[model samples]
Target: MDTLNCIECFVRSAEAGSFAAAARRLGLTPAAVGKNVARLEAGLQVRLFQRSTRSLSLTEAGEHFLREAGGGLDILQVAMANLASRQGQPAGVLKVSMGVAFGRLYILPLLKEFLARYPDVQPDWRFDNRPVDLIAEGYDAAIGGGFELPPGVVARALAPAHRVLLASPNYLAARGVPQKPEDLSGHDGILIRSPQTGRIRSAMLRSGDGRETPLDLRARILLDDPEAACDVALMDFGIILVAMPHALPYLADGRLIRVLPDWYVDTGVISIHFAAQKQLPQKTRLFIDFVVEQFRLQGLDRRFSAR
Candidate 1:
């Protein structure tokens, strides 16, 4: 029996609460994961979990064992990753998570140069809007906004996640253009539902002079994705509030213009998240540096700001 493999299965199952869940994360069959855990329990002479057909829960001994072993397992994995990094080329899969629209608009363009520089590092990137469990999900890095900082994870600020109200010229002409937030009441409003909270986003717009006002609008259409909202606005459907990154292309080409130029929504800063380890894998470190440097060179920090 491989003690290390059994420990890994045990740790992942303990964290995930099911052998099936751990198997999904570890790329193993559920039976294999269960067998490994069983072997570990036999070797340790202690039952680790209370297993049923519908649920899996840790025994008191299992909780104690997890508390003692989880940190050491993380250290071991980090050390192994760093060892691989130090030996010649950093050759491995670099799994990362990011927003679909944001990643395509901004980060995807840098992939060619990134591959040119580090051909050995294979990029396995997942583009989605929802927050991910970086550790359990086995992501080397993630890039998005408003992720809660979990233990063993840290975030580096990338840019301000600023949302601005936008409209097409044709729509503004037909709707007679909203001169103030109060005028927005009559116009068709394209409101976005928050991906994180599953609720319609409501905000108070603030101007440069410290004045604030609620963005009171009678919603005509509600969409979950910002990209969809932007498309709807482009088709002269209505005015939509969207992040600056998603809205910038249309604004640049004159397909859309900011409705309230002085007022904007500050959702917080966009960031790149990764494991907070002293010795990160060389590929992960290199990728993070390349992205940050590119953002700096392109002045994206300034461009993404709505203020």
Candidate 2:
């Protein structure tokens, strides 16, 4: 009787809520997972789960055993993984998700170097704007902004998710510049509709001198995509709000100029999100560390600072 396999099946089943879901994660049949867990219960002389046709749940004794044994099992598995990874290389498919524009611009460029470093590691990267369910979707990690941190997930902040109002020179000149936040009421605004909430975002901005003002601008155009809003601003349609990374190049090349340089929407931080666990798989850990290092090396945090 492999007690270790039984323990693993028990823990996975407890977290996944059913034998079938645990089997999907463990690459085993539901019957096999159930058999292993049954053997484990028999050895311990206790029933772990109260199983019914509709649902599976942990009993009091089962919960106690899981609480006591889960961390130990994780440590043991991590130790084994560390040893295996040292022998040759960390070899596995690392599935990750990131925002489309940001991923294509920054993350995609770094993959060649990452692959060169770990030839055995395969990268399965999803470039998307839609927020993902990390655990339910079986992703190793995810990166972006404003994602709800589900239970048993953690985040590492890579950059400030600071947003700035932007407008092309022609638009500003023709429409008349908004000298103060209150003055934006008369300006043409291209607003971003939140994909998650399905509502148009109207925000207030705070200046360096602690002056906060509500933005009551008229929305001539509303869209979900930030990049598209930038394009509309470039076409001299209206003022649009965009992230610093997306707006900086245009600010430099003079395609777009800041509408309120000292004022910005303090959205939050752009974070690399992953499952919160004591011992992460080697490849996943490496990728998280690597991306954080890249942000530091490139000065993305400072450049995108809301202050």
Candidate 3:
């Protein structure tokens, strides 16, 4: 058995906690992955995993080996990719994860140009709203926000994740527009319930001069997704507080209007995240630069801001 292949399988299985999950990532069958892992354990004469019908956990030896080998594996892979880039055009599957609405609105448009520029690089983009385990799930990169920066991952800011209050013209006309934060008492709010916290999202809208106003509105509809909240707001159901990336299209089309232009919720930044490697794969490097340059050319960073 190829020792490198066996080690790769072992590492992936340890990270994913199952052969099946590792197989999916490696583009191999579960049996192949398990066999590779078994081969590795046999050669070392040690049990690496505590395997059961439902679960797979790493043994003490496996845990220690992962700690020692994981970083080395990343470095080795990057080195190999770097050397491979010299032979020909950078070619491989570039798997990325991003929010559905944001990716479609921004990143998807760049696909045609990106392919035109680097035809050999195959794009395997996953549109997901939930936070993903980037390395464990085998994503080459991810674009979104609110991710905890783990040891080997890095994030590059693309835009401010500033959230703004929005209302449809029809809704505002009937329900009366709120001139001030305090005036939002009787208005119906399409509020987001945090998937991580299971609590309704709350905010203090801040202005340019550092003035803060508490956002206290009636939560008539609860939602987990921002795009869905935007859709509900478009139906004239109620006002919604959503990230500007989600609101920009509606705002441009006049379907939705910023309720209080000066004030917005300062959530954080929308970023493109990838692994922190000494040398990244050519495709990953190119993709990251392309996205960042596009954001710059589009002035998305400033546009997404609440100002």
Candidate 4:
């Protein structure tokens, strides 16, 4: 009557096509496997298999159950593996997928410290603007900016990020800084379209009286890459709305000035995501902890400030 044992018996029977074959795989007696299957069917109040003296086949309901049950078993196995491996020394190649600009600005630098701590760990990093299937592509982890975790993956936030309105000093000097969000309607604005989602995003500004409004700028150029949009803004082409992390260095150097500082939008969280498994591997766990600490030390929480 053990639920796990019942699942094991059911999965093996489905794959082996017979209780006897399943019993062999499970190291249980054929009669035991048969009894477990019957007990499971009785508990669920549904017949899981059609059996005759010569042959065995799954019922339609059993077929559906098997599909769902098999996945659960796989997760159980993965969890066990992760827990067993946790206490051991982390080694081997760790595959990481991440967004290009953020990875370059944030994650890549942290890798040096991680590698120094775990000399045996080697990293395989892929940076792209587009999203990749972590399970399908066989990546151990991914750092990305988004609230929505892809299905079948577990995510943990590493840092917070916000979208802010930014413009070059020269452009602001020429066009004159907008005292209010509505004033953006008279200015040239650069829009950033996400390559992965193809969604356009702009910054909203708030006034001293707590009135919030969206800036309506003439879209002089539209680009999918945020860094490229920053480049365009640097050339004094138009105002750019970008994540604070991406614009930090430029803003600090006076090349770009943050505008509409009172208003901000959470672009997305920078997070580490992996397959939702019960047991995370030692290497993956170490990296996750390391990145979280790194972000904290970098003062990620205070990266944005109202001007």
Best by TM-score: 1
In model 1, where is the ten-residue run with the lowest total lDDT?
82-91
What is candidate 3's lDDT per residue for 199-252, written digit by digit as tens?
A: 996688898889998899898999998989998998999999988888899999
The C-alpha TM-scores of every prediction are 0.94, 0.79, 0.93, 0.71
Ordering by lDDT: 3, 1, 2, 4
Residues 229-292 of candidate 4: C-alpha lDDT, one tens digit per residue: 9999999999888877788888888899988767665556777888887666677878888888
Winner of 2 and 4 under TM-score: 2
lDDT tens per residue, model 1, 1-307: 2998999999999877788889998999999999999999999999999999999999999999999998788778766766775346676899999999899989999999999988888999999988888878778999988546888799888899888999999999888878877888888988999887878867989897889898887788899998999889888888899889999999999999899798898888899999887777788888999999999999999999999
* Residue-wise C-alpha lDDT for candidate 2, range 127-149, written one tens digit per residue: 87877778655688999885568
Kindly report which residue stretches of model 2 are placed more than 4 angstroms away from their true locations once superposed: 1-62, 65-69, 86-88
lDDT of 1 at 262: 85
- Runs in model 3 lying further than 4 Å from the true structure: 86-88
Clashing pairs in 2: none
In terms of TM-score, which candidate is stronger, 1 or 3? 1
Per-candidate total of colliding backbone pairs: 0, 0, 0, 1
Residue 267 C-alpha lDDT in model 1:
81
lDDT of each: 0.88, 0.86, 0.89, 0.79
Order the candidates by TM-score, highest first: 1, 3, 2, 4
Q: Quick one: how many clashes does candidate 2 have?
A: 0
Please estimate how well model 3 matches the true structure, expressed as its whole-model Cα lDDT.
0.89
